[model samples]
Target chain A: MDARSPKRGRRRHGRFDVLWFLGVPILLIVAVEIVPMLGVVWISLTDYNPLEPDSWLSFVGGENYSRMLGDDLFWQSLLNTSYFALLYLPIAIFGAMVAAILLNQQLRGRLVFRGIFFMPVVVSWVVGSTMIMWFLDPSSGLPSMISESLGFGRLPQLLQDESTAMPTVAFVAIWKYFGYNTVIYLAGLQAIDSALDEAAKVDGASALRRFWHITLPGLRPVTAVVVMLNMIQAMRIFDPMMIMTNGGPNNSTTSTVLYVYRMAWDNLQFGYGSAITAVLSVIIFAIAGLQFWFFNRRSVER
Target chain B: MSVEAKHVQTPSRGAAGEGRLGKVVTYGLLSVGALVILGPFLWMVRSVVTPNEVLYSDSGGGIIPRQFTLDHIKDAFTAGVQPFDVYFVNSLIVTVIAVVSNVIFCGLAGFALARIEFVGRRAVTVVIVLMLAIPIESRIIPLYILASRSGLSNSYFGIALPLLVTSMGIFLMRQYVMTIPRELDEAAKVDGCSSWRLYWKIIFPICRPVIAAIAIFTFITAWNDYMWPLVIIQSQDMQTLPVAVGNMAVVKDQLRWGTLLAFSLLSVTPVLVFYLFLQRQFMAGITSGAVKG
Candidate 1:
């Protein structure tokens, strides 16, 4: 594109007028993403607290970083966030692939089923988390009702139990997010050269064999995308913990983002919050880069 | 590059779908998945119609309500945890305005990036891509500080500002615009079209598919956004639906479940409406934006 564009030179009325087009977007990006990003990095280094006087906002170097390292909750939240990513990644990627494959099968009312599956993708995590909290509430909710109906006593609290909370939250999160990966996989499925599968079939290849070689390999790009974005989102998870558990039942569900929000807003520990944010930003960038490179290399090797 | 609407409209390969047993298995599995997916949302609708007493009563064998009532739904507006109507209007205003700005700004920017030869063009693209890599949640602290400092806090513009023009929208438009033949620009220029006119007339009209993609994506993102609105909006009246309704997180009494459930249903209504009206667009837009990107 670089070589061809210069050779084929896009002529116009001096093209300078178009610079303003770039101007507005660039301005907004700088203000919203760029400025705040720099601010976050700066604030992370200090002991700034909104409630405190300006004197308290003095630069404290890497004190916030050392504090974060010493903080037990920071480590706990990091682990919880990592746990969430581990729980979310495989199930989400695999489930979406299966759902996509299922939807691709010629079935009655496939479009309606597509809508049914994709319903969660449109819903906010707020709506999802709020509804899931009630729907999964221990005693008076659906779980207990069904348990009692089956001659078992009331079901144990799902969200209230420390052991079950993270898994429960991750499940609901998966329910809300899997639809997106499914759509992506469906698109990837459609994008595959169907003639390969058809030819494989004509060669008497079994459905499993065809799917294993022709389908799965063909889906590498979307798979890379799905896995990378899903992991990043899971690591930065907030709504599930914030709305559902409030990082409670022994703070088991306290994800890193929820921890950041807690420190920054709830506890007014702005510096520590920004420190965590800076760390998270770097981690997200690293994961994204690794995944992109990994996927590109795989594609090149193939 | 998207191949969204046309390809999804027909299954290009469905050899297994042709088998009789495969049809049964497919429908059966899809039905189970559908049941699991739709269960909570359906229960939400059911709870919305059920009165508080019935919702709390032992007579209910399931989350299903034996009787239906509109009282809870009505209370969602009047007896909200926050100023429900105000939040609804705020979300509506913020979402609509943000979506409009996304289209205009991203349209111009996308066209510029794709077609116009300009300085810092590649740099802008790199920056947007890098922005996309950074998670929004990680940046909320500084976003809040900026919002408050700029006096956008507790204001609709504040709520909408950060999201007004998205990196995804810009990238979606840029990718789509790249597909537009340079001849369109050439011919338009030769036919007395200025740069702005070339964009407004030639590129803009041709970019409707991606525009639909951008519009729907931006609308959903803005409408469904919670973290930013939760951070920026300070006043009770300024809360968006998600923040407002979501704060009703604790219906610990179980009897108060109906109202919160009603609020949940209320907050989700607009999104459901979008899904119903533009079902394919939702699938196509999301598929292309994520997959192609």
Candidate 2:
């Protein structure tokens, strides 16, 4: 392996070899990702508006950040996003765990079952969110029909009701993503050493005990990854909120990203929108950092 | 490798003494799960074929529609600000360019990071990993500004530029490339093959599976992307399917249940068809990419 290292190879080296291979992607990333990332910080400090080109050159200091602190809608949207994550995270993780265990079983049509579960993941969010709206539509949806058939009284308009809109949106988000988490979990479950489970069985351990002791421990790393990724995704939820509820009835389902979108596009408040985005970016980075620290500490301890 | 070997052995262990009752329970549970998972999609399809009269009627909600019609689908194509066909073509153009650029650019970068002894390889890898943790949505404001300022907005290139080389794609390709034995490259070098020749003639050809995986993932993602395209492309004729469908939802009048459902069905059909044909590879690609990350 050392002999095969390009640095030590017999072939003559060129000064620009790295540039040849890395130039295009590096340039693209810098232009698209890196530049914009740095620009967001600057943009957040200014009162820039696309609609009024004159405001683009002016800086308003920390006014945007101060305004965001006092803005009820910004705080409400942040809370709404947190609420969605809090509700969706446990259900998605636990449901995916259960589904992954079932898929991992020696059952007929397991592959078909996996495919069925993952079907929603392939469907675009626009479609999934739209279908969910139709499914929950009080006037002519399945929920109302089912309620009527079961004599369970009239169903509320889930998306249009402030009390129910956030939860309904969260449920749709969970439905769209749990299959993906399940696939990751299934991969994690498959990677666990079967011999450990078999050994526990031979020691007269019950199925529940084996799963609790062996399988659960084996899946900790995957669970951390799944939890962190899902949380980040949930915190940034936009499409479902945009499509199904539009941050209404009365901003109940407004996510942080959706709020940023509205501020910038709908209100033409680019600086204020960038300020919220900066806050969100910080929060997300902190969450990710905390997750990595926790996971790395746990792995080291084991 | 050990895990895979045990996976093959464990199935036999489960089958040897498992009860008929257990099998029944497994099948029953899986059937219910499948029904729940597929129910919404079936309802979407049902709505697409159901006439507006039946769809709006009180007694009309079922997996099977009372009366069928393609009129809603026909209207969905024709009843937008711009025809749905234009949006579909715009989506195709953006997605095609994105997929091709991702494969070429990410493939080149992945190969270099995996095989080349670059001066700043470690730094580049760390930066990519860090970038993965940052959600692209958080950076949208500035990206939108940059695109607008550069006059890339409302064009296919603007829609495709930000997505041309994903950090995940680079990481996925790098991981796959690393698994290709170094001896092969060394042997190529011994045969007097230039570095470019080695990549083009030997390495790239062997990376077909990973390339396919990247292609499918990139294509689906680029096709289904909404927010970026919504911000970038303003003109009705230039809007992608997701953006156009999103606009339809917002407009209220064009968003009748039948028409909206038909629109949803049409928008997702291509990716759904792609997944149906290559699900194994798609699933493998996702799980492998996730595990490596």
Candidate 3:
């Protein structure tokens, strides 16, 4: 009995050793990810500037939040980001669905098509943004030259024009990201059983009816996942806007992230940036919670 | 055998004319979509080979030269240019360290999160989910302050450390690892193997597919990351690929379209090759983690 108890103790000690491997990294992740996030929240309550002396700063609760409420750029950014999400989400998701359905059909040279679409996803956003920038350049861009050729008149540099800047960014985002979503949808489509289509056919269903009744319903889970994923991605868009537009012409295309970055880095208003982050986080969490709620509802309904 | 054969074979007439029209339309739309998708890349390549005079002259016309030259490609690195070789190297070193560390640390953390029944697991999962949602840009300022305080602002460790604890990585590994049966752990335990030894000797090997998936994802993400490097690494010698291109654009006044395009294409080659080599696993990775999120 004594010998057996000692063995059990040794086994317990060995099990405890596994904790060592995890303890440090878990702590580090908490420190870096959670701690700074908390700092963002705290700093939102205080006026802390990285450039100014620490002693010169003062705590002003809710002032930054109220100021943000009235800040013109903040509202503009909110509008732009919303416009971006509104335009890109439905169009890109619909486009990807269409693309995925088409590709799911029996076709030759399909691999080449798959590879072509997937290329943009793999390409860095920086490269894509720069290429798009060149393609849209006012004087020497390909679009301008094409317009001239087609006798459509010289195209205004879209990125430079405030009227077109936000849309232009959205267009690029769609182009770069649709292929990724399409591939996911393709995987989802493949998972669907063919038996349902056969049953619908045997019931003398029309092609359109078959699609509406069978295919679309089958793709619900994937569609939900795609919509939520794209929402978050589209909401946090910054690099492309920063590189291509710089919130430019007249802050036409600035996003929340870019605004926050400019606030923190350019204006040295760390506290205000933190406040923007807080607001943005709340909005994101709300959207994500809505997605989860909808998802659970669907599952329950089935 | 005959029953199976009959089950496998189903004779059917192809769809009628209206269906044919639908197929044509679908294919046509897909073709146009492909053109839209591949257009920029083709133009990016064409502009590299075509002289600036021709590229700027014609837009939609076929610009692929019957005879091609490496002049622009050469000029990207040679034209009394700082050349991107150094940028490539710096990016490579940083990406390697970051990817390697993320793979190891995230794997262990993921295993713990997935397989280990311990206190605070639910909280850890919640934290990871929330972290994944919070944009990294939000925390950039504070992260910068922390790095500076730790004297890690410009070093490899500084750039690599913050990224090492990716919430996506933990989530990915947990999802993949969860699919494996706990009975495997029990079986190993019955074999008189310690838990640490079981993980090192058994579980790690079985987790290769997930590891590969994570490794590729982490590497690509780190490779393309521009914002953090842009803020932290101030010097030219320490610049990554995207930073180099950004700095080049700033310096050249954005007029050097040909050279800029060439540099852009050059920078994406390693990533393009990496994708081609691991196409299957990469699709799996993208769908499993990034797409779901």
DockQ, in order, for the candidates? 0.56, 0.54, 0.46
Highest lDDT model number: 2
For model 2, residues A211-268, the per-residue Cα lDDT tens digits are 7888898898999889888888887899988888788887888889999998899999
Model 1 chain B, TM? 0.90
Task: Kindly list the per-residue Cα lDDT of model 3 for residues B204-240, writing each as its tens digit.
Answer: 8888988887788778787888788887885677778
Clash pairs detected, candidate 3: none
Error of 1 at A133 (Å): 2.0
lDDT of 2 by residue, B8-78 (tens): 46542332124667667667767887877777787778788888887776676454665879988898777
What tens-digit string does per-residue lDDT give for candidate 3 at A210-239? 778778988999998888888888878987
Show model 3 residue runs off by greater than 4 Å.
Answer: A1-15, A52-57, B1-18, B53-62, B65-68, B79-81, B250-254, B290-293
Structural similarity to truth (TM-score) of each candidate = 0.93, 0.94, 0.91
Tell me how far the alpha carbon of residue B285 in candidate 2 is from the true structure, in angstroms, after superposition: 2.4
Give the Å shift of residue B217 in candidate 1: 1.0
Question: What is the CA-based DockQ of model 2?
Answer: 0.54
lDDT against the true structure, per candidate, is 0.81, 0.82, 0.77
Chain B only: TM-score of model 2: 0.90
Q: What ranking of all candidate models by lDDT puts the best one first? A: 2, 1, 3
Candidate 3's docking class is acceptable
Q: How big is the positional error of residue A205 in model 2, measured in Å on the Cα after superposition?
A: 1.2
